[model samples]
Target: MRRFLSLLVFLGLALAQGLSEVWKAVEVPGGICADGSPYRFYVSPGDPRRVVLDFQGGGACWDAATCSPESPTYRRRVEVQELLLAQGIYDRLSAANPFQGWTHIFVPYCTGDLHVGRATVDYGGFRVHHQGARNALAALEYLFRNHANPERVFVTGCSAGAYGAVFWADRVLATYRNAQVALCGDAGVGVRTEDFPGFRVWNPRLPELPGLSPDPEVYQVYLALSRAYPQGRFAQYTTLLDGTQVFFYGLMRGERLPSEATARAWAESALRAVTAPAQAENYTFYLAPGSQHCILPRPELYTLRVGEVAFLDWLRALAEGKTPPRVRP
Candidate 1:
């Protein structure tokens, strides 16, 4: 009986040690969420020189109807404490994940601005704070101060977070001069340049890209990053019939809920945006069939294939500096 009790205690200690390696929620000093709560991020200790920064994905809102306290979109805010306890691809212990053991920084999304909004707007009697850009800058500053040198850095995100990742990739690369960087934006194909005015209120800190229009499309950001970092890698993944992107594009284009035909047209336009950069050697993409929204969070991430190429394998190749094919449906 004593032997069994001793063994049980030993097992308990082992389990606790393993759990300690998982992500822990850390509140950023002076950071604030859209709802006025304190902003926090999850950090799991690993190799300081190798890091994977993942931005949490939730829908975005720009106006009174979407940003109101009672709206459905407002409820999608990510709670960092809850996220630290959940197991997903970002978890270092996930056997299927390639990024295991890398220093993982999970940036939670709650500002409802795709991590780029900078203004506080009044919605009738209520005031909504759109300070995503400031929030991300705080987190990045924290990371840079602590991990002064990084050998390999990957910046990525899904859904709205994907836009955040792309928007911030150049800044991240600039901060770490010698680090080899790669960016993968999943399901963040945004609206056209004509619709840019709606988000222009956010006053995104866009990087300078020569020859592109003053108000370039969102996908154009990827191209600009590519030109800015010729030695770095860039990739995007999405379904050809992604209804989530279609809906957002339509809404930005003045349609509250787009018709099937209208949605298809917008999806096609998004496809063109991604493919244009894929034609460049440093940029690549994987566009599968169906109406699936995001990839990194799905179990299908392990099994989804574009032709004979598995999605996981493709991601692995990209991380290892191999140029994978630009897949299409």
Candidate 2:
């Protein structure tokens, strides 16, 4: 009875939060994206313009790497950190400094793993470059078939989620006919309170937080993804390569630089479709100054509590084939 009651409670919250269904509308059970992948899509009743695919753990995709286990490594990468924050430990971290609270939310949006299985497309692992195109294709098809004609559609996640957004834009060119991906804390550049890249990468004033470390192994997954895509998508990148912390990702210094360089070097990379002229006007890149990841890209410019208003402008521009204005903060 307790288990059944818990299940009921869970279902109630999922519906209320609009996680599983929409209110005042026929509940169309979102399938594995008409393309046939085991992923889930959530159309928020609060805002249908907002379609969150629930990747990184919220979605039912078999790609497990996109979300993470109970490791800080996963937090720094893209995983639905809202799950982590519910835990007592994350609460303490929040109590420590609430202003920087979203870092917990933004990181997963950037570097979460990208793995998609089933027919149509199967790369074995998630590659932002490849996954971007695939996801964009899925999005385009869905839009046309559903006839959504939505004013704006944005994909967001923490850590890994953020990374996927950046990867999608960096890898999938043309910005998609009706969408623009925003990779929050895209590369987690200046998120940490302590470190800063280039000129400085550490917060000497504050002691290094124990148990925090970079998971370069995560790069292996990215590298595998990149190797499959000799040609990338976006004309530029918004890597959060801020120097505040080197926990999950970092600079491209010396021989180790090629990997780091890819984030910005995306513009020069190739794309899948041939016969492409210059595409400079299609995309814009923004970097947070002091953080290691996408925790705090431009706080002053983007209101945390304002919800999706700020991002809608850019989304509208991209959807209409107009270049979204660059955000220089």
Per-model TM-score on C-alpha atoms: 0.88, 0.37
Per-residue alpha-carbon lDDT of model 2 for 1-329, expressed as tens digits? 99999998997676456422221211123322322233322222323343333223212122223222322322222223343233321232334222112212111222212322223223254222112223333543543355344333343333334334433333222333354333222332122112323112111111122232342222222333233322322222232333212322222222223354443333222121100212333334333233333332223323322223343344334333344555433
**Number of the predicted model whose TM-score against the real structure is largest:** 1
lDDT value for candidate 1?
0.77
Question: Model 1, 28-109: lDDT tens per residue?
Answer: 7767777777787778878898888888777777777777888766424446432433444654567677777788888888
Question: Which numbered prediction scores highest in lDDT against the true structure?
Answer: 1
Residue 34's C-alpha lDDT in candidate 1? 78
Scored by CA lDDT, what does every candidate get?
0.77, 0.30
The residue pairs in collision within model 1 are none
Off by over 4 Å in 1: 1-21, 74-77, 80-88, 208-214, 254-256
**How does residue 268 of candidate 1 score in lDDT?**
73
